[model samples]
Target chain A: MNTTLQQFNVEKIRTDFPILQQEVHGKPLVYLDNAATSQTPTVVIEALQKYYREYNSNVHRGVHRLSHIATDAYEGAREKVRRFLNASSLQEIIFTKGTTDGINLLASSIGRGLIKPGDEIVISAMEHHSNIVPWQLMCEDRGARLRVIPINDDGEIIFEAYEDLLNERTKLVSIVHTSNSLGTVNPLRQIIDLAHNKNVPVLVDGAQAVPHTAVDLRALDCDFFVFSSHKVFGPTGVGVLYGKKEWLEKLPPYQGGGDMILNVTFAGTKFNELPYKFEAGTPNIADVIGLGVALDYVQQIGYDAISSWENELIQYALKRLQEIEGLRFIGNAKHRAGAISFVLENIHPHDIGTILDREGVAVRTGHHCTQPVMQCFKVPATTRASFAFYNTKEEIDLLIKALYKVIEMFS
Target chain B: MDELRDLYQEVILDHNKNPKNYFQMDEATHSAEGHNPLCGDQVEVFLKVDNERIIDISFQGHGCAISKAASSVMTTMLKGKTITEAKKLFEKYQHLITAEMSEAVDLHEYGHLAVFAGVREFPMRVKCASLSWHTMLQALEEKKEIATTE
Candidate 1:
């Protein structure tokens, strides 16, 4: 409510990035690859610099003053994440290497106890390899079967198929909140409710969602949510896994090294409680503090303003992209967000990516780590232009101008 | 623009649009499928060998202009050549693309392959330019494994 149109300044937001201020290849850089990773603002960068410059020490175990500082900063970041998702308690939040690692942590730890030989795990066709492979690996290990929910041509999930997939045998339903390759914003609440009716828990991949729009885990009521910090404008190699208290308590520990233990002897080892049970080894201390600052940055801007501005940018981008001859959009979901994928009639996506790069227009080319989506669409890959709140309509015009040069050269 | 033009020359563009020997050989003595996992671009190289000589060479796949044109040009240069000669040419081509352009690469030794010299400027795309070549090598060796431009 505080972020009115007057308070929400696009130029001020653009200044926060500073990476976009420079030239890439003889022209100003137009960075539109937010889905893959958002640019870190000065606040986040300074937070990281301060951590390493001021207090560089191991956390959780050290008895020294520096270690206490590091531990508090790291734990404080976890509280920020808990608040960011609006989860019930700090015990629900677990630090992970990234989204892929978070999913792997759940799949390996949960699959051991819950997934039986004949059980089935359901996932959508639009899931990234990160969300898909871990489940496949877990299912293989447990002799469980992996089931896929089909998608419509628009890259939206078919609710009927999803409903059909849920039954007594279904153990978990994992789906992406916003597809990275296609800008499809899935109906997470509907999905969670359907799974809950059958006593099946759901895991939401919010890597593409949390950055573009607001996400409240308490409201959605999903059992688990995973996302990468880098995708949310924080440092890379950091992510969070939020699980309800019951699920976190039920699942076993993920990895073991330093920390994550109450006691260790020659005979047995007693694991720690709550979030620490899953967090093994010395965590990414500096980056974790950086993530806290990043969350603060996002919360300060207010998602209300961020959402409206990004919606306008996406609409403008879609309209401008349509003006290009032979360009066909890959996804047409009614509730899309952040990213847009399309292919030039006879040109491969990578080729378009290459030409665009020369003009200082940065867009993601290739599969975007969603090969199944690529296979379903019957295209080798698509050139995806994903946006952040820092992006402007003027930047979109630059992208369109660069795209015309692509046509001129290739035509 | 000069660098972009260097990467996508007239010959490369023509070859991409109207590739020679661009088909699946039903009776290929040897064939190999290649994948650029990063881009999901796939290519298949088929070869008909008679007495250690490549009687005919062809390629069919889905890929970007650089990859497709590279395959097309490779097929054009490979047909009717002995396996040893093909291997020698591939070795030279690999060096040509990866070598520093600042050192003044001899275009005479490269010919059509010299167009890829621009790839040195764009290091990320070097794999795209060499995917088909690696697959062709795999085909010649009769390796059943799918080749990858890792």
Candidate 2:
């Protein structure tokens, strides 16, 4: 690692996000809903504008000059993603609509082809509905059993139980690297290792993890990883799915359409190679290119600095939030990333969210697409304040103050 | 805090804390469960009708003040009224909040429900306020209303 030249500046970084400058309900917007979707940087917005403004042509097939430029930019984005996750090859990365689409693509394709009766698909209790439903549908289709590894009170996955769940019958072990609800960062290395021992493939839901921390596919050694671009400062409707070459090649295509086929006749058709086979349609070229720019922006900032800044923000928020009376903080996992779930006694989560929003503080207040997780916690819903690198302690203080107001109103 | 207090008036809070007709009715003709997946507000509405008249009504649940108050008031107002009258009252009450059938509602008799009129300002809470009423309608097997899990 090279010694840092210029230290990361939080104030300078905040200026890059145009939406953050605006006021909502008479107060400055303190966006804490980054886990849902991050606000795009000016560079990313400009990239999208530049694409439509300059090279607005269909990619891959056209022999025209603009087509070549468009194709290059689109494929260039793929290379950026290839480096972003530290995947061994560009062929491993496939673009989908978002994280849900990516997981569904894997589950529908591989789960349809390989999984059989009596086989088991192991998933953790912390999985989003996107991760859980696809496996459930696949298992239902294949006569395979769906097994869940439960989480502890601390919201971390019980690694011992996860190991116990892994056996010869386990076909796939899909788990979220970082939980969206609890901010629990699961032990993926041990999870991958245990699954690999049983000749099972592991698909990591990296939607929450990719935005907050460094994700090295080579180091984690997971067979598959998926994350959405929107959650990481890029446009919505674009996500990256990285799979080992062998696994992707063996699995069938997800959706059959224009771009994925090499040659088609009345009688038969031949599919295109690796990622193109999976992509299968006119992709979100502009957004993917913009995602490349977002990745570039993050690379410029550097993850180590981002992590340190966010860790400080989280610690500060947690300490201050602890002081409010009747404010019960949920998900007290030792290892966390940019999420805080809690409840103000006698106040509905929706009310808390409403008041917070009125104070120009945006937070998620619901089951967060994880109804089962809410069941485990024995709460109907919780107000979740998720942070990002651009977020400041000032914003966290604003949240604390607003939450205090909510407590007073409800109690 | 005052805005929230305005939303959760003394009447709403009084009902929320010690709700009127808050119990399971014995020998009830119909009972239905209202579950809001979003906030986890689960309400069970029990109705006892005699010759199309709601002789007694009650509700039991765990929820926010708005939901609790809505159910409590709904049960309180429905008693001693015919099923048709109760249906009309629900319509007038809903119209008062949603501004859908505002013209039909007198807005005087339904004054307690007026506190909930602000509920329409918050779209998400609209479902929370209506969950119990929709559940009650479902228990009565009224075909016009639809029960939803918010």
Candidate 3:
């Protein structure tokens, strides 16, 4: 409904993603799996090609011309990430494999450093396994406790419950900014403020959020935030982890390797400063460069336009899906972004996924790596359709039509 | 579309909707839990084996149609068969679903399970179709360990 979204040309946007132009199973591809990974724009792909073709060399410690070009582009990507997240300095941005790697780095470095025995780590029930497992492992290792904040039936985290769990012993609160399985966008600003009140640092898993919403780290003031490049139309195998300067400075380096070491001897090794300390061996250079261009591409389109357009798609999807008899939406939170999960009576999500795939409507059907959320919903799994800015009303209609076919086949 | 229809044949749908021998067998001589972590599909196979013969078999769990139907067909077919005979049938069934067998091979040997031959086209669903049978094998072996179709 926004004027900017109204004027936005979706057909042109679709053209940017070459994969969307293809047909699957004799029907036009209807890609609705943005939460898993978004289709890459040609510009991002071109950036990757240019990097490999023009200047391919290992970053840092190399004095050669190609190395300088590669290192400049690589570090430039870090600066791009810093600017994208609105962080204060490049020291805050650490390159990672993806969200999983980022969280593991923090859990190993900070979790091992600060967390003492009997300390408590708080996380929400709707967290992806990446967010949940790393903290669980940390708690297990440190003899600390991992406490989960419960969610309502609507999939929103209960603020009152979260407050009750926050105490002096609560050392850190790691939660998802937006749930991957459930589309609920947590009240992060309030959540951060609440944790800050208890002097507990919070790490936000923003893998799902960065793709769909506008995230300003300074504005949110969360201690740590992580997201993957592939989810934002960039290359896979690369992501960003943004930590507060104070936290990054205090935590020990995660992996000890070439880039992270200042000096090494039989006695001990001096670790490099903030960002480099966390980044160990050679990072995904080409993908990191591609990620920078991906961020620029998203910025070019603007988040306001993206969010507005995706919201329209979600509303249209929800309304049309509601018309199907016996269809139950899994997460119906008041505030949602990117994805919608649901189940039809007496039908398995896998079967639905198969039938939909035959119709060329690509959707994810499984526990979505949130088994606890699936158990909370009392279903083995739910079929999920995640939207992007390029998805249109026509695609929603196709999805609805596919669902009808699923129901007919099952019945 | 033909592959889809074959995968979800009428027989599979009927068994999935109303799975035969789908109940808890408290007095079972052997039992094993099967799990597919990928999709959260769980199956518990309970067998009453007497003198190397499977006198009775039943299953209890929740999964997709392929898995549920496969479990139903497995329970029905394994009953009244000797342990050695059951193992042979299991091998043949596994081959039927997983391998590209010649058309000359009589699928009637697999009976109700021939419907699942379509699963050969869907490589991912093979695990779903075989979860219960794998658990059944574990139960027959009297293994206490949980069977995981990882």
What is the CAPRI rating of model 1's predicted complex?
Answer: high
Clashing pairs for model 2 are none
> All models: lDDT?
0.91, 0.87, 0.92
lDDT of 3 by residue, A98-183 (tens): 99999999999877789899999999999999988998899999999999999999999999999999998999999998888999
- Candidate ranking under TM-score, highest first, comes to 3, 1, 2
Compute the interface RMSD for each candidate structure: 0.7, 2.4, 0.7
True lDDT of residue B20, candidate 3: 98
Each candidate's DockQ: 0.93, 0.52, 0.88
- Residue A97 CA displacement from its true place in model 1, Å: 0.8
Reference-based lDDT, residue A154, model 1: 92
* Per-residue alpha-carbon lDDT of candidate 2 for residues A1-411, written as tens digits (9 for 90 to 100): 212214657889999999999998788999999999999999999999999999989999899999999999999999999998999998999999999999999889987789889999999898899999998999899999999999888788888888888888888999998899999998788888888888999999999987788888999999999999999999999999999999999998989989999999989889999889998878999999999999999888888998888888899889998888787887999999979999877777877787888789999998899888988888888999999999987899899889877766655
Which pairs clash in the backbone of model 1?
none
Q: What C-alpha RMSD does candidate 3 show over the true interface residues after superposing them?
A: 0.7
Q: Model 1 segments beyond 4 Å from truth?
A: A1-7
State which candidate has the highest DockQ: 1
- What tens digits encode model 1's per-residue C-alpha lDDT throughout A1-411? 334446678888888886878998888999988888889999999999998889999998789999999999999999999999999999999999889999999999889878889999999999999999999999999999999999999999999999888889999999999999889999987999999999999999999998988888889999999999998899999999999999989988888866899999989999999899998888899998998899999999989989998888899999999988899999999999999999988888888898998888899998899888989999888999999989888899999998888888888
Model 3 chain A poorest ten-residue lDDT run: A1-10
Query: How well does each candidate superpose onto the true structure, as a TM-score?
Result: 0.98, 0.95, 0.98
Q: In DockQ, how does model 3 score against the reference complex?
A: 0.88
| Off by more than 4 A, model 2 | A1-6, B1-3, B100-109, B142-146
Q: Give the fraction of native contacts in model 3.
A: 0.88
